[model samples]
Target: ERGLLCALALSREQFVTPGHALVLRLVRLSAEATAPHVEPALLAQKPLLDRHGNAPVYVAQNLLEQLAARFEFSASDDEFQAYRKCLRPRSLDENAPRPLVGRAIELLQFKAVIEATQECQDGHVVYVRGMAGIGKTRLVSEFLEM
Candidate 1:
């Protein structure tokens, strides 16, 4: 909660530093400052990926390496995908749509008009249609309520 408050305190206009990488290389010559023998040996080892094309492994590795060096996280592809999914937002809740049948009936009105004109009956099977929010659905609801 405190962290959230602190984050909320930050202004959207604030400028933030992205990331900075620092590489360190140490050389030792036979338990001491090594000449340059290690450089050739290290270069001789073939890279994990061939030079044909950027493989998924290399791409994922590069992404993970960048994320690790920047965010201090070295996650696998599945983990990264899961984390990315977390960043995505689900659409608005559809379980309960707005303007419920009763509420829509209230809005559509005309139910009173229908009741006044036609006698109410069970299974009336009233069908209302309109362009956009013209209240056809609401009309049906109002009639149903009556």
Candidate 2:
């Protein structure tokens, strides 16, 4: 978080800038540091960087080494197609409903879903059904935000 914040401030660009290599090195070091506590399954699931030319690994290592020598980290991809998959920004569908404010009444439906799940012995799906202009999506979005 600290390094990203530093990069964000330093770059001052509108879009995501390069410095991702630093994040990878930091996560790698953190995972190694916390290896004992983390499950093998979790580490196995993590994406690994092979020796490739997407982004230079040596540059990342040098930056990490330089930064590590200066200050401690107190706070905190693949090929072209793979990189796109990894770095793609979450885009909302054109018809996706936007969240509506001042919708406290919608929370009752959320609570009902929660209560139903608690009482059920078997797993069940709580489908939010409603017609157009109704606030079903908005209600669910609010519930998730909460």
Candidate 3:
């Protein structure tokens, strides 16, 4: 009964609905009956339960705190400095758009293949294979512009 109450309360906190609130109330009543007798004053003093007797917000808060503490990371200054030393900085104009050159014929061929595929219902795969920095990306960029 306690577990069921807890599950319902957590669900209610995540996605509130009248149905969940109703079920939670029913479960809480059942849980109260099954629980060992305790004074009303003492029950009210319990930190986990709220005025309505549901602890969903408290439980969720504690769960998140525990998870954050468990996964918290703190790197030392020396470690951070060492990690930074291995990084490569990019040039200011590395991503600047440049006009494609000397690949007009390849670009036209790529466009023709793409147009041919559009006319058919079947799927087609196009592979642009070339050595590194051989203008494959540039050709594709130019083709897309057309």
Candidate 2: tens digits of C-alpha lDDT, residues 54-133: 32111133344444433333221222211111122134475765445567766876677677888985466767788997
Ranking by TM-score: 3, 2, 1
- Cα lDDT computed for each candidate against the true fold: 0.33, 0.43, 0.42
The candidate maximizing TM-score is 3
Clashes of each: 4, 0, 0
How high is each candidate's TM-score?
A: 0.20, 0.26, 0.33
User: Predictions ranked by lDDT, top down?
Assistant: 2, 3, 1
Query: Model 1, range 30-100, lDDT digits (tens) per residue?
Result: 75653554432333232434333221111123233223322232233352331210111124465543333
**Predicted structure 2, TM vs. truth:** 0.26
| Candidate 3, backbone clash total | 0
Mind giving the per-residue lDDT tens digits that candidate 3 earns over 41-63? 23223343233433321122222
Give the Å error, residue 33, model 2.
73
Greater TM-score among 2 and 3 belongs to: 3
